[model samples]
Target: MKLKLAAAMLAASLPLASMAFAQGTAPADLAMIDACLKTAEKTGGFGGACVGLVADPCIKAAKGANDDVAKWKACAARELAIWTQKTSEALKKVQAGGFTDVIQAVNDSQKTFAASRDRFCAVFDKIEPGMYPGDASYCRLRETANHSLSLIKLGAAVNEH
Candidate 1:
């Protein structure tokens, strides 16, 4: 009877563990990104500011004019995620405190981030031909949209508090 119960528990836990893995939240990665973004966003209105700052220097070091576009773009994508994540965190923090100043910052940054992502999407639409192309532009658009949603939710959460 005990063995049967143990087997049942193990079977149940296997599905639960798989569910967690499928979610891909990676709490440690999320927390680290959140912390970095928080500090970066506080210093600059958007975390992308850090990436933008580096982009120019990286471009100048390249031997060919068009040589670094891919590299720069890849960097931009990473920075965008970091900035968006930071903005999301800031939105939550502001909601926690009901700080009016942070609200404007969050809204403004969200717009900028969205615009950047939209520009990326435009590039994607120009080239790739597919119903759901697994492209960087698509990823950026989704990230920006998610960040915007997070801001809205954070505002509501703060208002409630």
Candidate 2:
């Protein structure tokens, strides 16, 4: 009877777990981003700012470029580089202390995240047709920044465990 109850409970929770995972960005993450933006606005520094904080200036620059494709591309490149470097460093930190399974999971998740980012950003191409590079770059920057932040937090959690 105990075993049956356990199995039933597990089955019931599966959908809830799936829903959380399917949402991609949880409410907590959105809250964090909002808090970070507020803090960044108040402080004008990256000290306690969230992952997107690093890309904030680049985004601003892109917007200020007045639709100049070259300028927008430049800002996008900078933002991408920042995201890539930070994510790589965080992943390495996690890998250094994680077990084999943990390391493998992190590796697999990063790849999956990258693929998802690309596909998600591709939608922006159609949103503003003919703005190919700029629109796509903006989407990539936002996605990469958010992913980098999540990876950093994940690394901290892994280290804690």
Candidate 3:
């Protein structure tokens, strides 16, 4: 667990992946988003720079601005994996902080967030086009990422005690 947390914090400090505009070039990997997340945390905001970091560059790499739609879904999935793992690790960090009240509150909120995510993403499913699948995936990704940040912040609060 400590190793996972250490790796995550280390990854967050790494620089963002440089975007290449040429076709057939996606991010070499998803670690770039970690840098973006760290930036978001530093600035006390969540979605600004981190948003579209993956998909935009991916589309450009795929075939430029008019790239295939599949690129969007693929990029979303990849970034989602990264964010999901981060969120999970952050939650674990909080769980180990040893505040019973904080733990109980976090557990409660996590349960609520899970239900909320399902409904929120399902709403996107009702939209037209291939939006349902991709939209839902992005929704889950965004929700999970936000939840992860919130947990990290919560852990900080616990530390302050």
Candidate 4:
């Protein structure tokens, strides 16, 4: 029957759909990484080099570092430091403005954003208990970088108004 054939096709496609979702970084993030890599390759600047190197450990870990807990811990610590510094500087800049309602909103939103970042990273912990710290560190790094960029754009817009 037509109905039975349609149901079977949908069932067969479910795994493929899941596989696609599970593979690779999101498109925007991939673009950002590619940009960073290109800059590092071209200029050899510290910022670009740092961002470019963040994934090296992960790639190594994928090959075998998963078996070496120490390496993961080190990578996680390094990433957390980068995330903390970037987020702190971004928040400070956004908060340094005049005591207006917009500034207050930005401050409140930052507190909320920090909480959200923790919760979002916690999902990685939930998925792989053993790799939690490393996984969460990478998540935090990506989220913080994105947040910093957003705050920078917001600050520019506020200044423009």
Candidate 5:
């Protein structure tokens, strides 16, 4: 009985122990975005700068802009949905895995959210206020990207749990 109680105590403490291992990626991610925005401004153009931000992993830290913007949005949305779903899975995993339970799920969700934000930021910056070419498409992409950012923020919040 004592042994069993000891084991249960150890199990209960695992999540809190692992939570200590979670590090903040916010500063680095924001720095990358800032750098990308700077590069975009320096490039002296809207489209190229935006695309550059999307492509540079160091800056965007996520890659998925290769496909058409519409397809990309669909993919990102799906990816985020999976991350959100996995949060519960993470909790369950933590309950069972002892320590590694929620780690993967939280990390996966964070990565997806970051990627979504980067994709959206890239596309959002491209839509100049007065640009004539593909104005409607630009608007749509911007909306999609904004939605992705929202998901990313939500994921980030969930990670705190």
Candidate 6:
């Protein structure tokens, strides 16, 4: 529960994405996802240039600090907010594609993914006391980003046909 408590405290104290930007920690703008997606659309994938566009810089900035793990988690949480937003937009696009069954399945899958992530992170906190919050936040960020990308790809492919 330490990770949960830490995350909650951090969330309450920080408006994550904005804090990351105001601190000059995350070089990429929060709106930069749009450009990444546009590049993905042309390149058929989010290449290295776009991958971790926000997180990489944020994490790098936090490196070597005494509370590096905590800083990394905070950085991940910041980018996670943007990815969460991107997930919503991508979900909407996929839903608008008019594949009722596919949409329903994706909805169910998303719910399950959230539940699973919460459960896994909670247990992970107990198992790895030293790495609780940072690891948890990184897990969340990775999953959210992957789900967002998946939905975007699905939307494009579905609409193509």
Candidate topping lDDT: 6
**TM-score of predicted structure 3:** 0.65
Instruction: Show the colliding residue pairs in model 1.
Output: none
Per TM-score, the best of the predicted structures is: 6
The digit string of per-residue lDDT tens for model 6 on 1-161 reads 32233233323333444354345433355558668778778877753355466766777777653547767777677777776656666676777788888877876676466656656655554555344445766676676677668777887777777
Q: What are the Cα lDDT values of the candidates?
A: 0.45, 0.54, 0.58, 0.50, 0.35, 0.62
Clashes of 6: 0
Quote the lDDT for 116 in model 1.
Answer: 65
> For all the candidates, what are their Cα RMSDs to the real structure?
13.1, 14.2, 8.3, 17.0, 16.0, 7.5
lDDT score for candidate 1 against the true structure: 0.45
Q: Candidate 1 vs candidate 2: which has greater TM-score?
A: 2
Candidate 3 per-residue lDDT over residues 12-92, each given as its tens digit: 322121112112233444457777767777787754467556655654576544555556556655666565556666677
In candidate 5, list every pair of residues with a backbone clash: 94-101
Two-way lDDT contest, 2 vs 5, winner = 2
Clashing pairs in 4: none
Estimate, for each residue in 1-161, the C-alpha lDDT of model 5 and write its tens digit: 32233223322322321132133223443355456545744664332233222222322232334424443333233322222222333334333433343445534544344344445445543675233222333333343334333433344445545
lDDT tens readout by residue for model 2, 1-161: 32233223322322322232234433444465557645754675432356544344545565643556556545454445554445556676677665678777766665456557667877876765335545666567667666666666666667875
Error of 2 at 110 (Å): 2.2
**Per-residue lDDT over 50-146 for candidate 4, one digit per residue giving the tens place of the 0 to 100 score:** 4524545553664453465445544554444443444444455555554477666765665466557767776875566365545665566566556
Candidate 2, residue 46: how far the Cα is off, in Å: 12
For model 4, the stretches where C-alpha displacement exceeds 4 angstroms are 1-52, 55-66, 128-133, 159-161
Better of 2 and 6 by lDDT: 6
> How do the residues 72-140 of candidate 1 rate in per-residue lDDT, one tens digit apiece?
444334334433444444455654555667655654554455446555666654654333232443355
Off by over 4 Å in 2: 1-66, 129-133
Residue 56, candidate 6: C-alpha displacement in angstroms: 2.0
Q: What is the TM-score of each candidate against the true structure?
A: 0.35, 0.57, 0.65, 0.53, 0.24, 0.71
